[model samples]
Target: MKIGVLTIGAELLNGARIDTNSNWISKTVIDHGGMVEFNISTKDNQSSIIKALDFLLDQSIDMIIMTGGLGPTHDDITAKTLFEYFDDIPILDEKYWNFLVSRFKKKGFKVSALNKTLALKPSNGKIIDNPIGTARGLHFSSNKKEIIALPGVPSEMKSMMREATLPMIKKISQKSIHSSILRTTGITESSLYEKLFSLIKQAPDVELAFLPSLFGVDLRTSSTDNDKFSNFLMQVKILLDEFIYSDKNLELEEVVVNLLNNHNLTVATAESCTGGLIGDRITNTSGASKVFKGGIIAYSNEIKINQLGVKKETIQKFGAVSIETASEMAAGVQKLFSTDIGISSTGIAGPLGGNKDKPVGLVYIAISINGVTTVYKNNFKSNRKNNKRITSQVALNLVRKELLKF
Candidate 1:
């Protein structure tokens, strides 16, 4: 089934608010074995909404999911527009009005005139209750196209989608879709696609999608039958095991924590330019205390020497961003925390910090695992925040690689 999504709001069109509804709807449709063929964003104007709806209907889409403009305020015109488009008169839904009144009364507040707008519904449309907010969703079936209108607020929209929209879609769409996602690191999207293109083509029933981010590349495979999809995913995993970091929906930090726990090992970190970000990532995972001992933020040369026990002479000779300082920091943290592994990062995440030889985005990462120390140097050209994020990702990837070697 092909689905069309329309996100409505002047704020969204003006970039005042991000349209996350489209992303949610897309993922939901894909997971339910439906495909999204068209997406549009429009302001909260009647003509604009009508135009978008006409265009989508002309495409002969099976379903249209619209988010926004279902509020009680004056700008909320989606319900009125749908009423006009269907040529249906607006009628007050007594049950919905009572529900709204009960909600306001429960909050120790009286229902105002503006709140009554939420009780208006198209004469021929069915009401989809919004449990989280005042505005109720409208379900209209006109011209053989199903339109599901939802509130603009993310929380209410998401709640209505999960509680009402998804079940209706599943009942109408008879296809059963199965999907699995494989997460990988230390490989580029092009390289990973090239390696798996032949296998993907051979399995025509299975649809493959590649999602790339700074952490890694995600491979999502979907098929009609559960058994076939499971078998295909197993085959793909066997073929790409070397490059696959996680096949069980685990993040990079979670994978590292599991590996360390399995080996009965503990880890500590000393960070400079990353500013405790590496430590933060590791500890963000649940049960991190089982493997994560602690970390130190050695941002200054004095702190690197005095706190992490980096040699003063080493920093004077090779600088803080050098391999020598990174290695020492790793080794010192490992000894201080009495952990089986230690990681360290020192970088120049730059808008200003750079030299002729050591330019901006110069990062040095070191990991000490089981008496072996490995250091890597990376030069990333991006904004300061992006550089820091990439540095943290690279550090985690390095630790993941080292753990795999065990």
Candidate 2:
């Protein structure tokens, strides 16, 4: 099945809201053996919505799933635009309207007049249940083309897709597509591709994609053949052994946390320039309290000295962003928090605050285990925000690699 995704929101175009619906729908479609032909984002206007729909239809897509413009607000015009484009009339769903009234009444609130707009469904459409929200999802079909309209809210849209859309697509689709994501840090996308090029060339049936973000390079490969996919995965493990931290697309922090859990160990972090980013990542993982003791954000030299017990002399000699300071910070945190492992990130993330000897984006990540501290230096070339992100990623990877040894 060939599918297209349409995201309609002025907020998305204006950067007020990100259009995450397209990615979710596209991935869901691909997972259910449907090929995503195109993804288009448009402003929340009738003309633009209609035009984008027509453009997708021109591609002869079997289905087009649209998200956004399906609320009670005046700008929410997806249903009206869709009705006009399909030459359909809005049929009031009295059953749903009553249900909505009863739902609101249960919450000790009266249904407002604006809320009634959600009860209107296209005459040629089937109402998709929005169990979690007010906006009802709709599926319209004419001849060979089908259009599925979902809520713009991520949780609502995901629930509707999983409950209704995926099953529907599965029944109509013949092709089965499977994908795997191998996440690797401390390796550039180009370098990873070069290492895996020969293996990729040998597997003609599988498609390899290098997705790079601040976290790392995610090597995603999709294949119709189970054998080819399995072979590609095996070769990837062999080819990129040291760099491949995760075979299941787990984040660096999650991977490290799991390793720590398995080893029955706990960790703490002392952050300087990265400013508690490493701690934030670790605590984001579920059940992190089991392995994460706590963290100290020693952004200032005095805090590093008093809070994390970093020697003032080390900072004076080598600076806060140096390996010596980072190593001391890690060791200090390990001793302070009484953790089995300690990690620290100290760096210069800036467009300014750089000199001849110490430049911006100069990061030193240190991990202390069993009183032995190892520090890795990185000179990332990016703005402050990206430099922070890069430093955090490497810090987590360092923890991950160290935990792997045990």
Candidate 2 lDDT over 1-406, as tens digits, reads 8998999898999999888888778766777888788989999998899889878888877888899989999999998888887888898889989989999999999899898889997776788988789898988886588899998999999999999999989888888888888888888888997888888778999988888887778887888898888888888988888988888767788888889899999999998888888889889999798999999999999999999888889999988889899999999999999999998888889988888788887888899998999999888874998998888888887777777777
lDDT of 1 by residue, 1-406 (tens): 7789999999998889998989878877766657789999999999999999999999967899999998878888998899999888988878878988898899999999888778997778888988877788999997777999999888999899889888777777768778778998778899988888888877888888999987779898888878778878988898778778887779888888888888788999999999999889999998799999999999999999998899999999999999999999999899889999999999899977889888999999999876678899999885888888888888987888788878
Model 1 global lDDT (CA atoms, 0 to 1): 0.87
Give the Å shift of residue 396 in candidate 2.
0.8
Off by over 4 Å in 2: none
TM-score of 1: 0.91
**Clashing residue pairs, candidate 2?**
none
Model 2 Cα shift for residue 398 (angstroms): 0.8
Report the Cα lDDT for candidate 2.
0.87
In candidate 1, position 109 carries an lDDT of 95
Give all candidates' CA lDDT scores.
0.87, 0.87
Any runs in candidate 1 off by more than 4 Å, and if so which? 105-110, 225-232
